[model samples]
Every structure is written in C-alpha cells, then in structure tokens.
Target: MNITPCNTVSLFLPLLFFLILLLIFFITPFKGNHFSLFVFPLSLSTINDKNITTTQVQVQQPHQPNMRIKKMTRLDRVEEGLAEARASIREAIRSMNYTSEKPEYFIPKGSIYRNPHAFHQSHIEMVKRFKVWVYEEGEKPIVHDGPLNNIYAIEGQFIDEMENSIGNNPFKARHPNEAHVFYLPISVANVVRYVYEPIMSKKDYYRDRLQCLVEDYVGVIAHKYPYWNKTNGADHFLLSCHDWVPSFYECNPQLFMNFTRLLCNANTSEGFQPKRDVSIPEVYLPFGKLGPPNLGQSPMNRTILAFFAGGPHGNIRKLLMDHWKDKDSEIQVHEYLPKGQNYTKVMGLSKFCLCPSGYEVASPRIVESIHAGCVPVIISANYYLPFSDVLNWNQFSLEIPVAKITEIKSILQSVSRNEYLKLHMNVLRVRRHFIINRPTKPFDVMHMILHSLWLRRLNFKLTNSQ
Candidate 1:
C-alpha cells in the first residue's frame, strides 16, 4: 500500500526475495547443501482455476553442497558418517557384489559369508569411517594389558592392537567425541590374574570384588566423561574372552545390557545377547608362542577320520569322554595323546576335529581346529560362534547335538566325501579370519571383531531412532 511509484522498486523486490529465502533456510534443517522440498502435488483443477492447465507435480531437489554445515560436534559427524555407511551397505546388499575392488582387501566371497556384498561393503565402511576411543581411566595388567600366553589371549591382543593401531586404516580415535563407540579397556582375564590372584585361597571373595571393579569403572567413566551417561553406555564396548565375563551383567544389569560385550563365552542361555553382544574367537597362545601352525596338511593327507584330545571340564565334554574315550578306533577321543601323538599334528591329520565346550560355552578347540585346517565339529548348545553375523558356520563346520555324543562316529561317517571336501576347502578359505597377525591385516580376527562392533553400533543407532 505504501509503495506508490517508489524510486527503489527493483531493489525492494530483490530484498523481499532475499528475506524469503533466508526465512526458508532458517526454518528448515539442511543435510549438507542439497535437501528435498516437495511441491505437494497440485491437481490440474487447482492450476486451471488460475487460467492454466492443472497437473499434479512432484519435484526432487538436486545435489548442491554449497553452504557450510552448521557447527557440528564430533559425535554428530560420527553418526552422520555411520548413517551414510548404513545407506551404502544397503546398496551393496542390493547390488550383490561378491568382493571389493578396494586395495588391501580380501574381498569376501563363497558360501562362507551370509551376504557377501553386504559384509564386503560393511567392512569397507568400517575401514573408512569406524573410530574407537579407549578409556584411559584404568591402569595396566587389568586395563591396558592381559594374558597373551593363555586361552584368553584375544583380550590382550585386541587391547594391545587398539592401543597401538597405526597404518592406512587406523581405528583409534584421538578424541572421545570423534568415536563411534568407546571401549572400556578392561581385561577380565587380567582382572582375574591381578585382582583375584591374591584371593586365590578364597575363591568366593573375588566375585564381589569383580562386581565392584566393573561398577567402579563404569561410574568413574560416566562421571568423568559425558559419553557413558549420554546413551546409558549403549555406545560403549568391552572385549573379554574370560569365562567369568557373562556374570558381568549381574554387576550392573542395565548398563551391561545396554553396552556391547565382546566375549568368547557368548552363551545365549547364560545372558549373552547375540543381537547386542559379540562372540570373539578365543585365540589360544601358549607360553610366549603362537597357538598352532598357520597351515595344516591337505585334505587328501588327512588320514585320521576324526580326533579329539581335551580334558573333560564341563558336562558336555564329560558326556563326550564317557561315550567316545578310547572306545572307537576310527574316532580317536583321547584323555592324553598316547605320549607320541602331538596335538597339532593329530588335528592336522584328522578330517574332522571335535570342539566340545569346556567350563564355558566357548572352547579354544574351534579356533585350534580352524588353525589346523580341519573342519570343526561343534558339540555345544547355546554357543554363538564368532562372526556368525557374516560368516556362515554351517558352510565350514558341523554341529552335533550333545545328546548324540555316543553317535559322533555315525555322524562323521554320514558326511559324504564331496561334502567333506567342500567343508575342508571352506575351512582353509576362512583361516585368515581366525589368524592373529602383527600390525593387523584386513579380515583377520581383530578386524572381524571391529567389524562386529561396527555392525552392532549401526543396529543400536537404528533401534534408538525407532
């Protein structure tokens, strides 16, 4: 009404347009530069009302990363990267590529992987974007170090690797805010060694101590940093191969259930949630030496039908020993390897290696069998095999019910020669994943553990959103 032949009419129009654009940008949340803005399809009748042909309209905005992103916190950038990873992984699943063309990649293939392209893409995303922040609140022995020369070696190995991860794909986050997940660098194996060693005479005394240690560690981190309380420890993780790790849930039921626990004893019946927790392979390292030879004999050379030589610790093994111990000629189940027979050589010579659970649901025999290139015959209930999310255990391994321990021979005999060969070949193909390498390698045990955690974080993020 006031603009009656204004001198600056052209300037006034441009200024009005500028203010409109500014208001739109201010009200809308932009992801990068380009964002979708629907035209809300108008009917032909609505347009024809204004003296033009009416038609429905749908518009898609084009890509344009022109504007600077609003001040993004480190965690914001992390979640953004993860969201992108999830989208790309979904695409990879749809595309169905067996292997990656990326450098230094093994490019997973074969029936060993549940979804070859999805695992491949997810692993690539992990290598590209995954970052970990190891808490510096704890001390050595129980915190920064663990038993490298025992069955719980994986706990120590992973801790050392993260603490010293370097090279093209570094996983260690320089700052907590930049991490997708925070690792509480506590080694339950080390905790048992140091904290429980003094109370070895009083075994029951350590349970309370262990619980307190776990609670104190969480409390300290939650108070010292905003990360733990932020998501109630959902983005935090701990790696432990100890048998006692399952009891950690009792210490702080809520926090333990929230965070990811990478454990060897991933017994579903014993409160190990496969969806949230991870099953890490228990790599046996004995007395400052590697567990077993890197490669075993050929499938043709494996003359022994099946072999097993382990102490009967748990009920499953007791049943195994009861039925098969020194009772069969074709299937050798020894209490001791008859003095002359070596453990590794026996396993290498056997086409199938028996892997029954010991004190815990996890047994080192699975990895040992893998190391020997022998097709593992798992004989345990409620055990979640490591990397089961990506690797199909049925491809390379066989599972016999514990109740049928006496019928182990018949089960081994029933497997056709063609199937045995396939299992053998697959076992060799998957050896790289179980190997513990120095300086780390793609798709190795450590990398697999990291990938498992990465997948869990993606799931966690999606769950939170819903």
Candidate 2:
C-alpha cells in the first residue's frame, strides 16, 4: 500500500537501527573482566631495525578458550618451582667464581669433572631444590625392594635411599605437588625374577614376556593417574640393571619414547640413547658385603703394568683374552687367575686394570679398578660409562678401542711415567664419586645417580596443565 514519505522514513530508520545493533553485537569485543570473545596470550620477541628492539605480541590460538578460566594446578606450582630452580642453577653457573670454600664437604675439581664449577653448582642447586616423588603404587620385592648386593645393587640402593625419610634425605619430595621428577621404583631385575618363565630352547621368549610386564605396569599407572598420559612418561623414570630394560620401549614405543631408563647396560648397540637415558655404574657386591677393600698399593710398589681376569662372554672379551692372555708378563690378561694369586690384591698391585665388556657393555671391573686406585683401561664398543654426563673419564681412565686390544701393552708403555702418575692420582680423587656408601654420602655413586636424573629433569619444562 502506498504511504506518505514521513511514515516510510520512520519505518526505514527503525530497520536500519536494528541492523546496526546486530552488527555491533557480532563485532564488538566482550567488556566483562571474566569473559572475552578472544583472549590474547602475549610472547616476547626481538626485531632488528636500525637498532635491536624487543616487543611483545599476542600469540593467537585458533581455538582460544574463555579468558576467565585460569586454572593454577598442582602441576603448575611444580613447574614454577622447577623454573625457579633452573634459573638459580644457571645463575650459579654464570656467577659463582669457584666452589664454596666454607663448606666442610669435599669440592669437585681437577681434570676428572667435565666442568667443575658448573657441576658443583648444579649439584648444589639439586641438593637445595630438586625433589622426586616416588609413586606408591606397586608393592614389595618388585616395587620397593631390589637386590642390595649384586651388579644391580644400585637399583635397590637408589630405591631405598629415595624412599627413606630418616636423615637429611634431600631428594625425596614430601608431596607429589612439590616434585620435579617422578620415580617408578619397579625393578626390572626383580621383574625378570618373578615374571619370566624360562622355557628350554627359546632365549627370546622371556624377553618378550618381560617387555609385556613393563607395558602392563605402565598401562595400569597411566590409567590410574593422569601424570603418565600427560607427558607420555617423559618425567617418569625407571631404574633397571637388567639388559632387557631397553625392550620396554619396543613393546609400546608410544608410551615409553620419552620415559627415562636409568640402566647399567648403556650399550648404544642395544638402543640406549644417552640424550634420553642414563648410564648407571654396575657395582657388584657379594650377598652382604659393602665393597671390595680399598687396598690400593703405592704407585712405586705396583710392579705389574696391567691386569684382567674375566670369563669370555662377548666377542670383545674373547678377543681381549685371546690376544693378551699369558702373552705378556706386564699385561697379565687372564681367562682365570692361577690358584694362589688374590684377585683384589692383584688388582691393587697393578698400575692399570683392564675393563673389557662381557655380553653387555658395562663391566663391574671398571668400578673395582677405580676402587683399587688402578687406572681403568676401558676396552668396549658402544659402552657409555656411568656418570659420563658429569665425570671426565678420560682423566682417570683410558678408553681403548677393541681394535687396539693387541696394542694395549704398547699403549700403556707409550704413556710417560709422569702421565701414568697423574692418571693414578686422579683415580684416587675420582674414587669417591664411584663408591657405593650405605646411606649415600654426598657425591658418592648413589648421589651421582640422583644428580644424573636431576640434570635430565632440568632439561624439560612441563606445561601448567595437569
């Protein structure tokens, strides 16, 4: 119907006003403090102009959540603590001129430590800040208790020390919320003992079964708790001296790719990655003994040049035995020592001890030699020594290639007497780091393992999400 211009203008004006209001509602940002259409998370970056300039810009997320949802979780507090700890460690490294002279404890120095100042400071920071939360999920024998007197002794020792709260235990976190790293105290050696059914003719069957046991354990914990699935076992660590620990990754790679495997068999050939895993020392103690007597002979009194007495298990040891066994009076490589000679005494009398690999890369002989104040001649391929992350093994020991097994005598001969003396002296200095004390004294082998874990944990910064 036809209408006057004034009436048409009024109707048209109302329609236009409604359309404008709709546009404003769609385009205008939310004004409430608790709610926003888009929340901008700012990040700092540098831009190069005529002069360097720093700026903060919003890091846009495609599917941004509501701004009001600020969740400060237990994991966030843990991360913040770790972040502060990390900063303090870095500051200590950059600023601290030397080790603290005031403390009564012995300071790490000399050529044996990679960076004496950095390691010392990092260790100090670890003692001051690092805390580990041991999962109280699994039960005895396999979970908490491990063999205290064997090559895999450190596994049990570490579990006990970390779990203990009696005297000045610095590594144990009082609560899970304060922890920087989580310990999965299951012993792989124990798992093999309890789980694996040895069937005749199938060597690999037990290995597969062992792998399943690990996978099942992970599955149980991951299902029970959010931690494992949160980082896919990145911050969780397991201690195992068994050679089969590496196979856990193979069983379920997605679940364990980032899980830290602290192991004695740090053989690169067996898929041991140093960047992700730790090389623990294999210290063999008989059922109830502490360690071999530190009967170190005087350097001048040590008549034998080098010594070794081990059965041939791998090709490297076989090659070592074949080349040097009874061949040289100075070398003294032996399949078995004669009836009369004392093993520890012979090691003490020798200036250098041969530490050739058996089936696995690590040999207990290395620690034995270190204890005896004898320079270790490491004759193994793809073997990563314990505490290699901190200790400069080259200073106290010699790493001879398998190809050079025949030239071991000439190699020892090549080192001048003065150089030999330096090595021998360094071995004595480094002995404390390898020694396995009952309660775990500072800088001892037990603490060194914790330090290794602490160093690794420092490398990762967990997100706020639990």
Candidate 3:
C-alpha cells in the first residue's frame, strides 16, 4: 500500500511540532520559569529587565525575509509604558548623587539601604510613572473595605489610603487602560469577618468558601475583562493581611501562582515567594488612635535590655513563651502585659524588642518596635523580612533562628554597647519607612509597601498566548 502524501506530511507535522516544543522546553533557561521568565517568539518584548512578556508592537526579527506585524492593543501601550519605567528606573538607579531639579521631601540614605541612591531614584520613578487600576467589582466590607483596627488594620489602611486617588493617591489609574498593574481590592480579612463567620468553627468550610470566592472573583474578572486572560493574571494583585491567606492560597494555588499577592503572613514555608510576591509590614492601628504613637525612650534612657509580649499562638511562640514567659525581669517576656503597664511605654524602654512569629511569620510588633526606636529581634524560620528588597535588616535588627529560643538573652547581651547603639540609631532611621502616615509621605509605610510592589512590577514583562 502506497502512503498518501497528505497523511505522510501530517505524520511529520506532529513530530515537527513535538520537536519544537521539546527544544523550547530544554533550550531556554525558562522551560518552567513559573511566571518568572516566560519566553515566546510571538511576544512583543523589550529586554530591559531579566524577564519578558508578550508584546503587540511590530518587532522585526534580525535577517528575517518577512516581518510579522502584531496589532498593538491597549495592553501593549501599558506594557510599553512599564518598559520605559523599567529603563528609567534602572538607568537612574546607577547615579550615585542623583540630585533632581526639584528636591524630594525625603531621600533614602545610610546603612539601612543596600543602595540608598537606587531606592531613592526608584521611589521617584515609581511616583512619576507607576499607575495601579484597583478593580471595583465587589461590594464594601469585603471587597473595597477592610478592618482598619487591631492587627489586621494594614489590609484596610492600605486600601483606604489609596482611596482610588480621589486627590489622595497619585498612582491610582483613572482608567483601566492606563494601568500598568491591576489591583483586586478583595479584602481577605473582611472575608473571614463576614463570609467565614457563620462557619467559624469549620476549617474545611472556611477553606472551601474561600476557594469558591477566589474562583468566582477570578471568573468574574476574566469574563468581564481581557487583562487576566492576557498574561495569566501576572500583572494583577490582591492585598490580604489575614493569616488564613497563606493556607487559603494553597487551596487554589493555580489561581495565585501568577498573581502578585501582598501578604502579611509572608511565610516562605507556606508558599510565599519573595521574587513574585510582596511582604507588607503588619501595623496594628488602634481604632481610636490616628497613627502609631511616638512612645520610645532614647537609647540613653532605655533601661530594659530586651522585651516581648504576645499570646502563644503558633509553634514558634509556644517555644518562645514556654522558654521565657515571666522568667526574667530584665528580659521582660510576657504572655500578657502586667496590670496598668502601657505597651508602647514598655516597648520604648526596651533596647531590643523580640518580634516572634505568632500563628504567622509576620507580627505587628516588628513595626511597633521600629516605631518605639527599639531594635527588633526577628525569631522565626523561613520568615522573609518586609521591604528586604531595599532595606538591610542586619543594620537595624537581629534575626535569631527558631532553634535558638534559649539563646535570645545571650544574643542580645553579646552585642557591644556601641553596636547596640548603632542598631538602635539605625532602627530610628528606618522608623519612617514603617510609620503609617495619612496621605502617605515619601518613604512612609504605605509608600514603602507600594515601593515593594513597584519593584515586583518593574522586574517582569507580560505576554499574550497568541
């Protein structure tokens, strides 16, 4: 039997396609870059950063006999703007003494930063070019609104601070087309407050409901808009300060694999990727209080050597509280504060504040300690420090391993007087970055959090499937 030409050609066509895919999988360093460095020939990309995404701009391949012209969409303009922003940020960051024509209110400096110039320049660049489009799909108390008091305050505070740029946030995109990144304003904290409250005792119900909510939310956005489908939700993000986000994230990992999650429980062990996700400071804003109170004694007046006060919520804290709770007067480790003892005043008096992980890698005491000018001693495993992209934690804080719960006292005492003073002063220097400011000032908490998000945005490019 003679083989037909069509059938023979068809046989080779599938084989050829298989070979091409094999080459793509094995050739590029990004076979499974996992939303980091996805490469494709059809992608319209500017290789300013190490990563790239699909582009619509007509780019002619070198020595090509024919040029393929891809029609530019609204996303192309946004990506191009991001490319320009990346270029500008990279070029400007190299300048050591970047004195702008118009002086900035605050310029990042000192040992606290890896590169003060880079951070300062990048902040300026973000302010100049960055635009975020916050989705207005869901209703209040769950979507747009969040808790602004107690531990989960930052989730609401950041959302509230944005206020959709109503003469408040300069970076809020007026139109979705102008946005470089889309913000899903769903508050996970509020979801637990409302959605999960009915089944408060049921863990599986909470997980299932959360999974459904996430799936439904994504479905709505994907159906209503083309943005999510364009880049597999890479240029999109959601802010959640609840501890459950880490676990809830696991239920629908695929939905979040590409999304930039701004989280407070930034536990690497629980799937927090430093490169793809953002770790925001967890600031505990009291309901009645306007902002974090200024309540720290100067290094000279600080008498207590180390301080820690919190409930034993997780394994790390259980180990911590079990070892040190009410053990020493000078150390002042407390499961609960003594009657009439002010939290801020006690924190202010301490030279070193122990910020142990309680049910999560993040703790409000980290910000609280910084605000009180007490050098924070980070104690946990797989806990990535917030704003670690720009700030040098060692300069202002100490990180003791979870195994060294017993050695905390020795570690704090080992620091020489001068070294202790240096750390204390550095803590004071970085206090501005951790402070929650209304109508956020440059380098304040909101801006610092946004800056981390800005860095994540600048690092990668987006592309379409076609």
Candidate 4:
C-alpha cells in the first residue's frame, strides 16, 4: 500500500521469501533412502535414557542432474559413530583426569600404569562409547562354546560374557550400524576340540584342519556381509588362548594381517605384533569358578626368597630348572611340588614368584602370582605381558632374562626390604586387572581385555577406508 520504492522492495522481499519456502517444500524430492540420522551417547550413565547427540544427514537426490554425492551406507554410519568416539577418547586422554558421578572402586595411579591419566581416560571412554557387534555366523561348540575350565578358560569366558548381553553390558551393540568393532565369535579352542585329531601322528594335519575351519568361518562372514570386506578384516577381531591362532595367519595372512587378535600367546618371535594385536591374560578358572583364591599373604610373612613349581614345558623353563632345581634352600625351583604342599600356598609364601615361559609365552602362573600378592618375576624372551599397553609390568613385576637364571636368587636377595615392599604393594595394586570376575567388575581381567581392544580400535580410522 506504500507508494515509496523502499516500501515496494520490503513487500516484494517478503513475497519472494514465501515463494522460495513453498518451492523448496513442494519441488525438492525427498531422498530419505540416501541418508540416515545418527545418534551418539554423550555420557556412560545416560546412554540408554536421555543424554545423546543426534545428527541429521541429508543426501541430495541422485537424479537431480546437477550434483553427484555418494549415498550414506551402514558402513559410513558405523564409521561416523567410531570417528566421534575416537575424537571424544582423544579429548578425554588429553584432559588428564575424569570425574564420574558413579562411584569407582579403583582409580588408576602409581608407576604400575604406563600413563595413569591416559589409561584412566581411555578406560572411561571405553565404558561410555565402545560397542562390539559379535557376528552370529558360526555354530556352537566350534563357534560359540569354548573350554571354561583349566588353562584355556579365558577364551570361553570372554565369549560367554559377550554373548550374554544382559544387564549393564555397555559394550554390546544393539545394531551393526552403531558398533565400533565387529567380533568374530569363533573359538579356536573349541575348533581344536571339534576338529583336531590329537591321536594322529602328523600334527600338521590337525593344524591344517584348524586353519581351514577359521578360514571358512571368516570367508562365510566376509561373503555374507560387507563389513569384513569393507575394511578387509581390519575392524573385526577374535579372541583365543589357543596356541594355534597365530598359525592361522599362515593360511590366510591377508585376511588376518590387520585383524585384531586377542591372544594369550603373545610371543613376538611367533609373529605376535604388539601394535595390531592384543596380549590377553591366560586365566585358569577351575570348573569355570571365580579366580583362584587370593591368598594375599602379607609382605613380611612371605618367607621364601623366590619360588617356582611347574614341569619344564619349554626351553626357558628347562633352563630355569637346570640351574635352580633343588640347588638352593632359598630358591625353591621344583618340577613338581611335594604331594602335601599346596601350589597356591607356596606362591603366597614367596617374596617373588618365578613365571617362566612354558610351551607358549603366556602362563596362568603370572596371574596366580598376582593373586597371591607375590611380585611376578617374568623370565621369558619376546613375551608381551597382558595389558602391558596400559599397565607397566616392570613397575610391579621383575623381568629377568633367561640367561640370568643363576642370578634369580641373587636378584631377589638384592632387592632391599623397601624395594621388595614397593614391588609387593604394586603387585597388589595391579592385581585387579588380572582378576577374572563372574560379572566382570571394572578394570578386571575381562574389562581390561575389552579395553585393550578398544585401544587398538582407536588406533584405526575406520572412516578412512578404501
């Protein structure tokens, strides 16, 4: 109604804005199929309830003839989630400390940790953001089931914990699109039980059968889903205490070179790379029960200077026995303890428990030593201790060379009472990380294993896939 040029311009601008809004609403074709909405948890406690960050992604219609943009697939969505988690964890690590509303049973500190602050922050981020999607491709006993007893128990325990997915298992992913890592839930121990023929004179035959089984399982998953092929098995992982796991690489090296292998036998000489793979504690759960009794003898009460009781299984143990077996009263290195004497009790009584490499680089004795409050005397070559990526083994444990078998007694004797006390105290402090709990408390063996995998995943950039 205004006659001035300014008034005419204002009225025209309003009309043009209305027309543009109408044109966008009616003329633009919706491309719901091309994009998806992603939501990430902001807090560990509020993940299920309310605390979340949602992102709405829009993809232009491909047929528009003007713009060409790739469609967002499940892989991209999953990678987006992982990318955000990686960023958050990096920030958390840089923070040097994390405060939580929920009570913490233990706060990591002291020389036992490589970086107490970084480890603490990384662990908190894992609890809050890490999610694993366990593949359901293979069958039981061979796939889902494993020995929950004796030396190979950790393989089964970890599998069971992941499959249970009840209560507050924050790491279980509801869908593959939200997962940061894919777990290939195939048990190497179970494969040995089902496929291996121990009676067969040719051990290579059994190994071949085992290797083929793993290859076939991975092949099935790789064919069925794009996840494995998308990243070339870099984002997928499998846990095994079986010594045969590393040998499987011989069968299909390309498929496993980048894959995260959670292994008990983290022998560097045997192709165990610390960067890509994870060294897991070999826990011996008698009848699938709780961890071996924590005798936890006081430092002063530990009268024995050094102790080791186990058959010679490998070259290191044989060397250890050759020098110290029945040679000294202070150093009790026996192939077998007397019938009446208890193994756990001897460990509890010792100032230092000698943990030598057996047939494999890993042994339950190291963890048992921790439980008994005895400072672990790690005597092996190329053996990467479990959780060494976070926990500093040298702080709580002594790493004596095999060549120094004769000095084992001298080493233990040389440690001043104050130094012995410090090592003993550190052993107790680091014991929680090696303890295998039923429902897996935080920082326990199970959680530590998961956290190791989480750390490895952080090293990978899934979004930067080819």
User: 313-423, model 2: which lDDT tens digit per residue?
Assistant: 999988988888888899998888999989999999999999999989999999999999999999998897888777888999999999998899889999999999999
After superposition, the stretches of candidate 3 with alpha carbons farther than 4 Å from their true spots are 1-73, 99-101, 198-200, 203-205, 463-466
Model 4 ranges with Cα > 4 A deviation: 1-95, 99-105, 203-205, 464-466
Q: Give lDDT tens digits, candidate 4, residues 1-466.
A: 5499988898799899999999999999643422221222122222222222322222222243333676675656755666666555455456666655566667888888877766776677678778999888778988877888888999888888888856658888888878888998888887777676455667545577777888888889888876776566777898999888988887778668667899999999989888678899888888847677767689778889889999999999999888989888899999988779989988899999999989888988898899899998989889988887777787898999988987887777888989989899998888888887777788988899998888776654444222
Q: Lowest summed-lDDT stretch of 10 residues in model 1?
A: 40-49
| Model 1: per-residue Cα lDDT over 38-114, one tens digit each | 12111111211132221221222234455566555455577678777766776666666533446744677889988
Q: Using Cα atoms with residue i matched to residue i, what is each candidate's TM-score against the true structure?
A: 0.82, 0.83, 0.84, 0.83
lDDT of 3 by residue, 1-466 (tens): 8899998998899899999999988978532212334332111122244455533322222232433986676756766876765555556565465545467877777899877877777788778778888888988877889888898888888788776448768888888888888888888888887887766455635577777787799899989987777667778888888877766568777767678888888888888988788889888888866456788998889999999988898999999888899999878899899999999999999999999888778898998899899999998888878898888899999999999989888888999999998999999899888877777778888888888888877666554323
User: Clash totals for all models, in order?
Assistant: 2, 0, 4, 0
| Model 2 accuracy (lDDT, Cα) | 0.78
The CA lDDT of each predicted structure is 0.79, 0.78, 0.79, 0.78
Best by TM-score: 3
RMSD of each: 11.1, 10.3, 9.2, 8.8
lDDT of 2 at 178: 80
Error of 3 at 40 (Å): 19
